[model samples]
Target: MKKRLVAVAFAASVASSFACAQTPVMFSSINLNAPHDNVVHGVRLAVLHGKVSEVKGVDFSLIGMSESDRTTGANFSIAFGANKINKEMTGVSLGWFNWNTGKATGANLGLANITHDVNGLNWSAVNYSTGTTVADVGLVSLSNKSTVQVGIFNKTKHIDAVQVGLVNCADNGFFKCFPIVNFPK
Candidate 1:
């Protein structure tokens, strides 16, 4: 019986050693509750802090001061935090200031939001996207090809859609600059 126990312990140690030797080791943080895994496949709560390489589930952070390579589920931050989803973002992200440096196919709600390629809704006080976006609703919205914009001031280069705001500017459209509403023909 004792021999069996010893053997099991030895095997466990050997396996752990091999796991640690891996290039990208994923494990919980030293502070028991916090986790710093290579990939988060479940809901994670960061009371003080936490981080992950990729998130496949919900991530709620309280003053979450960390970054993620990519996120498929929701990413929420209390104070002001950001992530660089270089690959893609397919879920909702809520924070005071949100920044998605990759392609986004979901929604972003915050005080300020920015993305490279936005294919979904962006609702904030100020929103900016380099690529075409489906919708932008904020106080000031700007995009290259925003399908719809509802804000105080809206600006876009190609508006194959509509803009409803105080001042709308479609750089290359029939109604290049209009008041209240603008559209391209």
Candidate 2:
């Protein structure tokens, strides 16, 4: 708790010191939570107020980084520095939702909570149903005291991994039941 207060105080101090005009912040290196083999190196920093900034020369160093996507295709996932989360710097994570009724799909990524340095992200969404509703797809911190659904659901496929989260549950188009998502014990 003291650390968070300290961080917020530091940020406020730093932000206050900035000129009324916009200024650029430089980051030599940052650890964005991403797949180990698919880790993106060389992050670039951009200037923005309450917006997602860019980190320069960032890309996956090796194919090992992408080893987490068990079944692959064109899916939407982001590669942030190991210290990443919330492009807007909102102290939360970037959330998403994509429901396909035919085949099961899942979400997988490396996550880190800046407040607690809690690094973890894992999820899977498989299959689609008639009226399955999606929720919990928004900015959230793992150390958050309350729980909100991330909307990642599955059809029938159950999955596990070192750094993966699963979602995709049985659905009747209106409501659906998601499976249990367990983190490292």
Candidate 3:
């Protein structure tokens, strides 16, 4: 009996230590006491809102989702209140406005889309990328290095592909600016 009790206690202690090693799954509320770390490794549901430092898995928010550092999975916010990504975004962002302060590697569909560096499509009424390497489609598309753009008015500092719109401007191309179609050497 004594030996059996000691074995059980030792097993419990080892199990508890392993549990603490793994980051807990968080369910955030404005009223509950939950994990408030900068990093989350599992799923998170923020009812009516919350913020985090970094997320590695799925995250859902009612009003808004703000990542102070980086996000490597999907994030959705019902209302586009303040959806800001400071470092990097590698998934889909669906909102009224999607703002990526750092590198973006996914699609952004909204009324307005802005990013510092992008490698995917930006489909919106107004799309702006400081460093674009893929495509931007909008009423007004602007980028510093765009590969292709289809819009009403397209502007870029350099183009390695083509632009199809009413007014296309390739600042460093042969024509400097053109209408209908434009390309760069």
Residue pairs with backbone overlap in model 1: none
Please, what are the lDDT tens digits per residue for candidate 2 over residues 1-185? 99999999999887786534232332222233322222112332211111123322322212112111112222222332222222111112222322222222233232311221112222323212232122223223122111223433333222122111254332221223334442221
- List the lowest-lDDT window of 10 residues for candidate 1: 21-30
Q: Over all chains combined, what TM-score does candidate 1 have? A: 0.76
- TM, every model: 0.76, 0.20, 0.77
Per-model C-alpha RMSD: 5.8, 16.8, 4.9
Cα deviation of 43, candidate 3, in Å? 3.0
Per-candidate total of colliding backbone pairs: 0, 46, 0
Model 2 residue 100 distance off true place after TM-score fit, in angstroms: 29
User: What is the lDDT of every predicted structure here?
Assistant: 0.76, 0.27, 0.76
* Per-residue lDDT of candidate 3, residues 64-128 (tens digit): 55443687777666655435678888887666677888888888777888877877888889988
